[model samples]
Target chain A: MATALNKPDRTLDQRGLLCPLPVINTNKAIQELKPGQILEVLATDPGSKPDFDAWSKSRGHKILSVSQEQGPPKVFRFFIQRSG
Target chain B: MVLATEQLQEAAKQGFKKKLVIVVSKGTIDMLYPAFVLATTAPAMGIEVDLYFTFWGLRVLTKKGVKSAKIGAVGNPGIPMPNLMGVLPGMTAMTTKMMKKRIEKYWPSVPDMIKMIKESGGRIHACSPTMGFMGVDEKDLIPEVDDIVGASTFLGWASDPEAITLFI
Candidate 1:
């Protein structure tokens, strides 16, 4: 069920992967989506938020939102829209 | 005139793409990991990346050398062992195995990182002088190498005004 402003066309789970892998994989994953589609990323790396922020800016993509899930492992969630 | 100047500045900012040029000169597992990490990550960020592997770092471009890379325990202040103990037989191997085990749990291997770098359109350049000095022919290099280049060529690539050059 996709919601307005919160729906993602694709989701990438990067748990257990460290710095650079998450960013690298996210770059790869975003390439598969059509322009303006959103990608949901679920990552366990504490560094993902800033990495995604910088990545989205440099690539001209937009990060719709970033939130954290407070689990024992602490997951970071990012909804990013592909640039045209 | 002010409006025209602002437009020019805006255009320049939008048109400039970031570039990263790294010179990797050590072959130790400890040394190579950081180099490969940056090499792979830069391309993912839409930054052009060029890695110039020279001296011992040329080993990483070789099939056998990449697989047999070891962490040097001798004279390494970071390792807990004293210099005398570090020089003991089998110490380097033991240290290498321990380090490899830890690294494998959290990161991709050197060869895998190289593959990812290539897949992301990063350039891997082998130093021609090192290849000749070490008696390593083109056949010894892994398939990912883009070219064998001299210092002048690598320096030319690094000379881009916006390129961030690093020695690792």
Candidate 2:
């Protein structure tokens, strides 16, 4: 689905954060958003990938996409849809 | 029998819930098993799991220590020994080593579990406090650790209301 329609209602800046931090912060951000709101997560931690996937599945939230910036300070960009 | 659209929607609504976690610290040897076993399995079950090694808990995550881990015995109050075995006097460090060797034969090693945690997308961290306390350089910690962090940093993750925090 084109989650591009919505400007992310929330932004989770998890740069330099690891593992559970990204997941935890993402969860908290989603809690603060309204139904159908979007959350954008920016992280440098490699562990975010699995944590994000697991979180999305268990929560029934939609993951729009994960875009990686390949370089020093590599970035993982998560565009997410908060559903039921 | 074909279900109605409403029934299908209801079934979808009843789907499994999301599992969210902030931190898991295995503070002792006996405490190590449950935390990592769940960590490796929880993601497959759709839970977001992270293992944060701190204090002596880091013992489980470090590769070198696993081979030489001492099992507590003979009135060793600190080690988590079974009640019956606690009174046994001959179980010294050497005996601990032997016991560890026998147990390792039956199960996945720390390295194996750490790999699973990483491949399955879980995260691992070594506590900075413990590292400093033990005068352990970052190089001494398990290679699986993504980084070294203090308690405040760890707390940031657990601050989320939806996150479950555990001290193993």
Candidate 3:
């Protein structure tokens, strides 16, 4: 199984959950990150795109990029920075 | 000089240790989850938490239509609606009702989340504007509200030099 990201301190693999799960779990992931550091989230939900955007806005984090990969799992990779 | 570096690191860590509090200004059902979940979990991670409910957001703190809170495309970004469904007049209402069922199925009740948040030591606030606009007395509000305050009260919480504030 591909775990998606190999990061220094923060990586969340949320593949099987639906709707709010990806957003909720990502919220938890961001609170642990350092101010300048980034959190990488790998999700399978297409809904993850807007959900993460709303979450990032309300949680005061930055969504640096959301990359869609071509594969069976339909990976949605999010690079988020903890905002001030 | 190694001791100096260690001391500097400690100070930097301390400076970044301020607690964050957030306010939820909207109460559409889909919007409520992000606020309640984040506020409840904040204290679990050792950060102080506060949630101020105002307007429709107050519905979560009141009994009139708490379970009916839902999202639509007028401005809600969270709904996964297709374009055809969005243009219909009753679409938001229909979508909201459908979402209500899903929320009831998938998550805890709003009242329960409020209880959990309080039990977990997070603070809840109701906006005075909403109360005034809706003609709601404190008794009309769910008992979990720590106080009835303006959004400015939460802004004050968020405004500290070291603190972070978010709107959900």
TM-score, per-candidate, Cα-based:
0.90, 0.51, 0.56
Which of the numbered candidates is closest to the native, going by highest DockQ? 1
Superposed by TM-score, candidate 2 places the C-alpha of residue A21 at a distance from the truth, in angstroms, of 27
lDDT for each candidate structure? 0.86, 0.67, 0.70
Best by lDDT: 1
lDDT of 1 at A78: 85
Quality of candidate 3's docking, in CAPRI categories? incorrect
Error of 1 at B93 (Å): 0.8
* Tens-digit per-residue lDDT, B37-114, candidate 1: 888888776678899999999998998998888999887898877878987899999999999999989888888888
**Ranking, DockQ, top scorer first:** 1, 3, 2
Q: Report the C-alpha lDDT of model 1 over A1-84, residue by residue, as the tens digit.
A: 238356688899998889988998899899999998989999998878877876776677888888889986899988888989
lDDT of 2 at B43: 59
lDDT score, candidate 1, position B147: 97
Using TM-score as the measure, what is the rank order of every candidate, best first?
Answer: 1, 3, 2
Tally clashing residue pairs in candidate 1: 0
Q: Docking quality tier of candidate 1?
A: acceptable
Query: Candidate 2, residues B28-99: lDDT per residue as tens digits?
Result: 334565676667655544556666777677766566764444556655565455656656567565446665
> Candidate 2, residue B39: CA error in Å?
1.0
Q: What lDDT tens digits, residue by residue, belong to model 3 across residues B57-96? A: 7877776655456677565555676666687798888877
